[model samples]
Target: MTLTDRLVRWRYRLVPDHVLGELLSKRWMDNAIPLIILVAVAAVFGSLIPGFYGPQSLSDLARQWGEFALIVLALTIVMAAGGIDLSVGSTFALGNIVALALIGVAGLPVWAVVVLTMACGAAVGLVNGLLVGYLRLRAFLTTLVTLIIVRAVVDMLLLRYAVAIAASFPDSDLWFWFGDGFVAGIPVSVVVAVAVALILHLVLSRTRPGWQVLAVGGSRRSAHNVGIPVRRVICMTYVVSGTLAAGAGVLFASRLGAAGSDIGLGLEIAALTAAVLGGNSLGGGRSSAAKAVIGSLIVMILVNGLVRLGVTSGANSLLLGLVLLIAVAIDVRWLKNRNKVLAKVYVSPTYADLPPAPGTDDGSPYALNDRLRPVEAIGLGEIDGPEDVILDEDDNIYVGNRTGDIVRFLAPDYSRHEVFAHVGGRPLGMALARDGALLVCIGGMGLYRIGQDRTVERLTDETNRSLFSIIDDSRLRLADDLDIAPDGRVFFSEATVRYEMHEWPVDCLESRGNGRIICYDPNSRTTRTVLRNLVFPNGICMTHDGQSFLFAETWACRVSRYWFDGPRKGQVEPIIPDLPGYPDNINRASDGTYWLALVGMRTPAFDLALRMPGFRRRMARRVAPDEWMFPNINTGCVLRFDETGRVIETFWDRKGDNHPMITSMREHKGHLYIGGISNNRIGRLKLEGADPGWTGWQSYWGRA
Candidate 1:
């Protein structure tokens, strides 16, 4: 390789361009924009306003911010349920007046006043809920009416009890503490607000009720069709919103001990501004407590900074209106185009200069031939994608299809077939365990097993995670192939940690090290990574020595050996560094050899594109996925190689009939069975000079 080529390869390898795509794919990325805005606003204010970050100023601001955040949280809940509560401001005023009247006029206990105040707010919310949720009224008009009615009631109550509340002096320690006390150098209101935020966050993210609320918000018709009580969930969201707003009012009243007509006027507009700015979706079903908090901080900081800068309240309101308009525009545009932007950046390509392809002309063992043409098709058009074929002790043929079923063809004739077991998530490579259970590597799921009782159980779906990796690689993404070791540990290959089974071709385009080999110990019930950073690790086969195994890196077009129990444990050595096609499943042959299936052949055009990562990146960006250049997987062949990596022979269907794209093959009882992920039948070829009685089950368990 030239110096320039080596530098380009190293640049792609070290920079980790894929991390940007991975981060963008995450759910938390939605908060990124708001979080950055919050920081920037705080920085600008801190720099401009003297003593803005001082302890005294911050303490005062924290108390006010906490109270405002409570109102925003209330709006967040109602909005998340696909409704809006414009009456929250009036509800806040009502709660404040009630709490004061109970304490001073009625001489009630502080706790009773708190409860009664919240109950009053809940009563108003119940009316709105009944009108909007049950009566199916328009949420916007319903809440707007509630706002006027609740404000009118608050005004009448204030006229009746305003003087008495102002005159009476309550000798309550709890009331005073609620107003002025501090806990751990933080205001009491801020502490309570933080606790409430935590509880609401958990409820929205971790509880069934929270899911129901989101479901109803996303689509009421779909939620009802799925048996969710959509109306009840919506009603409950309004009730929760009212209760939270009242709770915040109690804090405000305790701190200031004042209530008037202007106390909560236009509060809803400010709270709405915070909610949308914090990244909460106005349409619902896409909000979190973190977003409400971020929005609260931005609005409060902006408002307070402007106030300190001698900006008029009228100007402040105008600026807030402008901010809300801008926030709404950004929220709508970002939500609509987020996935489109991610699609453009997510398929990161990397440079891979593979060695020269070996010649497949006549005289070469890798030469094209019609050896597979005479093979007999067992099921023909009756079956679906049987990616891998295996056999049991009784000679019954077992193959996994795309419909998530392990089908069994009865022995002798191979004519009658039945659904052996239904293991979901597209079963890929399968193996016969020594204990007679059928172990399978389901593509999107983890390792699974179908026992003699026909019950399917999951083995392991996760492993130890990489410490510094940006993507969460703990969960198995594509468990492609597996093999059993002598000590009962199962070693499996995960094709790619970055993509799912349907996106396997994208992995080929990138040609990066996103695959790994994992070992699951049955005794300890633990799974760990045995090998890492392989390019599309596909097939795994334990060697005869019982201490080592050979694995095929499909996109790299090579086979390598790894020792797990010998003196060379944890060492990886290349066996076949070059191959003519993308190798797949490796199985033991009856003649002391191994059979490997090349799932697809490499083309000169594609090989040249691999060397030009920039060109591939542009193609992925400019073209649709179906139109992009993909590996030619429609044609492949099965080949036999000895222990020394020497190709003994190959089998191909030159006419492209019977078995054209072979993914796996197994030698059982003098017959070679061929399976392809894209074919509708299983192929059988009679071996003339082989062990007729050697069954894979017997080889592993010794004639149980």
Candidate 2:
């Protein structure tokens, strides 16, 4: 190999380009930009302004930020429920005046006054909710009208009670402490804000009401069709928003000990700015309390810094407006293009150097022929993508359909097929247990079994997780095939950990070792990884000795043996290093041999592309998925090999008529039954001079 080629291969392997894709796939990545801005803003202000990070400065900032966070969180909730509340600023002023009037003028207890203040806010919100939700008015216009009405009420109330609230002071220590007191060196208002944020976070993320609110926001018609009580959820969101706004106003009243016209003027703009800047989607359906808190900090720091720098009020407003516009633009554009970005970066291709494929020319041992063309097709056009075929003791043919069903065709006639079991996942490899249960490896689900009475049960869906691995490999992604050992242990192949069953083509593009062999032991009710880092490990078959098993790595185009019980336990030895096509499933033959299915044939051009990882990477990025060159899977053949991996014979469907993509085959009662994942039928070929009474069930577990 050239030095340049070697360096390129090493660079792709060692640098872990796939890590960036994995990180981007995470949901938390949406918060990345806002976090960066917060850090940058804090650093800049800290460096430019004197005593910006000092304890006294922070303490005062905390008091203001905490109160503002509550208001922002209130706005976030309303926005998440697919509604907007323009009345929040007026609601805050009304709450502040009510709290002061109830405490100082009415001589009410501090606790009662707090509750009354929140009630006043709830009353205002109820008016907005009734108009926007039940009356089916536009949220934007309805809330705007409510804003004017609430502002007028607050002005009149202030005019009447402003003098009394300023003259008479409340003697309650708790009321004063609510504003100035500290808990463990943290301001009380800050502590309350944090507590409320946690509760709101849980409510939105973990509770059913929160899910309904988000659902309503995402699409009201869809949410209503799903019976989510859309209008009620929208109504509740406004109520919660008003309550939270009023709660923030209580803190404002306690701290300042006064009520005025400018108490909450233009507060709604600041709250909205923080909500969108912190990564909450303004178009609704996506938001969180933590985002509200982060946004609140950014706006509070910026405005406070500008104010201390002696910036004019008009300039401060203008700057905030610009920031809001930028934030909204980012939110809208990011939401629109996030999935497209993820699709481009998530499929990272890696360098793969496959061995030279063996020749399939005429007269060669792997010669192509039309032998499978003459085979009899069973359940033609009725069965759908039967990936594997098996037979019971009575010659009853069983096949897995793509629609998550195991179909059983009766013996002798093979005319009528019945749904033997509905396992609800795409069943791939199946085996008959000693007690008449059929064990199956479902594609997305893990191991499962169907009893004789047709009751389905899940065996294991997870295995021991790999420590220090970025991806969670414990959960089964694609349990492709399986074979049972003598000791009740079922060994299976998970095709790829990074992709699902539908994304198998994409996994082939990566050509990385993302597959693993897992063993599920019924005795311990435990599943564990026996071997890992194989390239698309597709099929598994236990050897006759019960000490080791053979498995096929499809993308690697090789068969390997691994010891599980003997002295060489956990040791791996390659059996077949090179093949002309991609291998799918390995099954035992009746004549002390094994049958291997090559699901697709290899092409010279594709083989060359595999060695050039950069070329494949460009292809994936520069073209549509359907336009990408994939492995030639539409035409393949089946072959038989001995224990030493010597090719005894081969069968081909060169005309592509009967069974083209042969994924699996089984020897039963003198016939080789073939199945393909892309074919609509199962093919049965009569074998010459083969054992007429051999069955896979009998070979594994002795005949009853």
Candidate 3:
């Protein structure tokens, strides 16, 4: 390749083709947000202060952050491993005492004392590791217990040696060098902090052990099943944790010129807050130590600068409290919180109605009808994330609940009735397989084919086996819906793994559309991507023509058609754009037509908000669940069209009587069966004399 070509390739490669866009659009990167904030702060201060640009203040600032930075680095690893260590402060004090005891009491050499202190730290970490890793103890509770015990032990040891250290006289220069020495204009402490960070980054990004640690943190069960030796990695994190805390202790002593009983007090929260603020997950396995270090530095700078600005100690405490709140807000629980962030902001609400199938639409070219209505209130009794729905040959209804399970209703009457499958993890879409079996696209768990006997079997789980062994999360995210070809080739969507179904808002807020259309061949028993790098591929529908299919790209609010055979083989083209609502499921109309369900209506506000990634992410991460600030597809509705890309008729569920968030509605046996991922009842209504042909086909071929 030429230089220019290579450069172009490199740029494209780094550009998160699909997932990266989703991540970037949502401001999902740990560094993305913090980096911006840091730059803004630095710019403001550097411009505001007369001597702010001077090297002296910068150097002092760098040096001043060593303690917190190192501590944060340790906490970053802990959080990344999916846990916390509230006992770090006690461990820090323990390290100082051990170093002092080794040098002054044991008369050990300087280098030996350093090694011994680190070993002592490892031993302390071992205890914590054993408790947390082997015993499977809650990290918070174990660390809390360890903190108290370790502090008590340190206090007792200090009282025993207080007089001896004082009388022994001049003490050791070794402790001072390890703590407060300078090397090439940078303090040894700062150098150590940087080195630790570099080492951590390498472990996290390049090493197998680091990968295991992350896997363990993110999902411990997943790491164990994948043969990652999770316990060993978890225990070792504590070892590293203790070592860093001890090292920080040495730095503390050198900085302070002496060790005391109250050494390294109350620093755990600072480290955790730093790690979280730096963009690491408290939910484990998603962390960056480097980001944590920078976060630590930011915290230190804020604290020091605030103090310098004559801020009261009380105000400083409040600032710390606020920083902690922000850090906590970055959690997965916070991210998945649907009630807080309105739908349209996190997940795009605007989806254009696909061109009507041949003869049913408004007789116009493909586009949303100008008559689209916006509603101020929906009368549907509490509905949640409606992913997809299914209907039986009898026209009985079934809705897949994103947060819960399936719901079914009686035919034509819309009387709520049953739940055929209670399988958990966001259930997206469902369809009746040819064999009289109900198949569901269970998000996180895989594509489940449930038999009439209610026997749930996972027919397709590994999507190309890309991360089979490294499946940190066992749930299947085979998104919104699926369509089976006549030959039983199941085409499904694998949406962004970066965000879970409930947490899909994060993906939207981050805008990293790492999505793909996967084809699962039943005969070959293989799942492969038909198209990769899509913006958040949602629903799938196969045409009775057997030549092409349609699917939704939710975040982009577009519906597209993909040709499976003939002249345009493997080609994809946009069928509709600028949808009025977030499109969910697409089903064939019984009367040689097609139906597209509108889950929510999109607004103009969302399009402009996409440009402001930071604001979007903040809204997702920090806003109230039901706050009107977030945009949502205004109301639930469905659209019908003939096969030739024409506008048919639009059927709306303005009262949510048919179901709010109309994820699915399949025409079967002269009745329209409506299902939703989060609807309380599947709805059924007759289309009067409509028959998609198969009247006697099911009985003739035995449920064909």
Candidate 4:
């Protein structure tokens, strides 16, 4: 390793928390150049100057600059987004003064003071947000003017009225703990500063708002294109920063027991220095709250150390100014400003390098799985609620089209097609008999059997007795999927016992979870519920042993397995939680494997579903009868799993971008016959390396 890299390595192993360990590295450049340089200067100064780096000296240094570092963190956020908040120093001073006045003069409780101080801070921040976001002004100049006005107001408050009241009320116990208090071990100021850093860091890195902040900073135009709320996010940043600043002010007054003119003195310079030193440039992207704190620590440590070393305060200021100037100049050393701005605008979210969210059967990892080869689209128009695919003895693909058509697509090349059955009223789930006759879940028309002569025969239209809650208007018009047991009995799921297909999300939001997994006995001509209150149960697949079946409860984003024959008979357990997408239909493949069709992805919309349950039920009751409420049907995908529920490979279609919606897929012989609930043409993806080991009847008949 290079000399500088070795230093960074050693520092990271030792004093890593101080500078985030970049000071010891050689390759350290870009945004963090200022911080690295400051650390190097600290090292050089401490080594050359006597008494520097001593424990007591460093502690004092850190304590004095604590407020400055806090201001820097607040300022860094504003500047990083190509905006400025010069009112920060004034706000800082006002916060400290207001907090002291509340506790000492107002004769109120400590909690009340904290709340009022925070509200005051938020009001200041909101004004800033309102001015720049709504009024539209140059951030630097706008904040500069605000700084003057706010400072004048602070001067009037202290020299005005609140200060006199506080001085006269020194005997009051209101300022007892707040003016000088400690809970467990640490100082309250230190705790507040650290808390602010930790929370904002998480909000920016892990939550949706953080993404929006970066997007707005990166490029307002680009942010809008990707659906980031450019104005609201930007405005919210001001609020967060302002609120945090207010909190810090409360701590300052509590610790000091006094508010003075010097409360926010020179805080802007130090905060700006810490931010630039720690990284995050005005180029509008790339800032970390953690690094900003580290930068703040470095400054605090240096000043305290110098003072403990018996260096004069004047000498320390001179040294810090020289070092910070050199540190900031390095930010401009690499690129002209314009290129830097453009780079931030074009970059995607930072964590794009991480793996996709769990259960994302997007086929990205299985792109080399041969079956996922990019091919021409034979053009499938919008198909409807297709729940299953069955290949008859003729090798012809039969798909249960939700629009009441048993659609057929030819083999080898998907060049020919015909209606194999037209059993109206939303034909959804489908199953092929041993003799190749099709059993279908004709929504609202009961399950139907498709005869060889292309005629539809009604099976059981309704259950023997509907549950009291599911009478007449049970909304079984949205039956989802089915699987046949070894005894020829079919088990199916009615996706909702209340709302129709369009309101599935509404059902989840309502937490009714009223769906049921029902059994259809062909001999008795009866349908009965085996499991009820299943929470939007959608997909069903019988196990190889016929003891139980696995079903997908879509709204819960989980898979459920019910084993009826084993020692664990009649019990349900989670097979998997948080499937990458919303599960729709599942069928057993020939090789003891299972294939699942994802109707749509579980995205941000689903998150909103959990919080707005009442809104969902109301919407469910109002939406039109035929409106399909899912996402991006233009693209759909499928997942494969072993008997143990381990994911094997993924097959996906990118819609017009690649192919089209493939809601249901099946492996027949060596080919994957694809069908969509709404696609006009059936997809035929040749499994180039696959063996013809999974034909439905052959496996069931022991003829494979």
Top TM-score hit: 1
- In order of TM-score, best first, we have 1, 2, 3, 4
lDDT of 4 at 347: 17
The list of candidate 3 runs beyond 4 A from truth reads 1-387, 394-396, 407-416, 461-478, 506-512, 607-630, 653-660, 692-704
Question: What would the per-residue lDDT of candidate 1 be over residues 292-357, giving only the tens digit for each residue?
Answer: 999999999999999999999999999999999999999899889989989988999999988888
TM-score of each: 0.97, 0.93, 0.50, 0.48
**Best candidate, lDDT:** 1
Off by over 4 Å in 1: 2-4
Candidate 3 residue-wise lDDT, 1-704, digit = tens: 45754564355446433343334334335477777766776676667666764777866677657867877888778878888889888988887777666666777777887788878778888999999988999889999999999999899988987666555433666566655567887888889888888998899989988898889987888888878888888899988998888888767655564557757676786677777777788888777766887688667767777766789978877788788897687655555753344343434322112221222244433333322223222214433554555566665556655555665655655534566667776677776677767777777677777788877777877665445322222234646578777777888877765566566655555444467787778788776767766777878888766788888887666788999877989888777755656777787776666788776766657655654444554564466645524447446677886655564678664555335556666666765656555564445566656865443124212444
Stretches of candidate 2 off by over 4 Å are 183-185, 370-374, 460-475, 521-530, 564-566
Q: Cα lDDT for residue 338, model 4?
A: 37
Cα lDDT tens digits for candidate 4, 460-572: 65664454442343335667677778788888888765556655544544444467887878888777777876767877887788788899887566777997567988899
RMSD of each: 1.7, 2.6, 12.5, 18.5
Per-residue error (Å), model 2, residue 73: 1.5
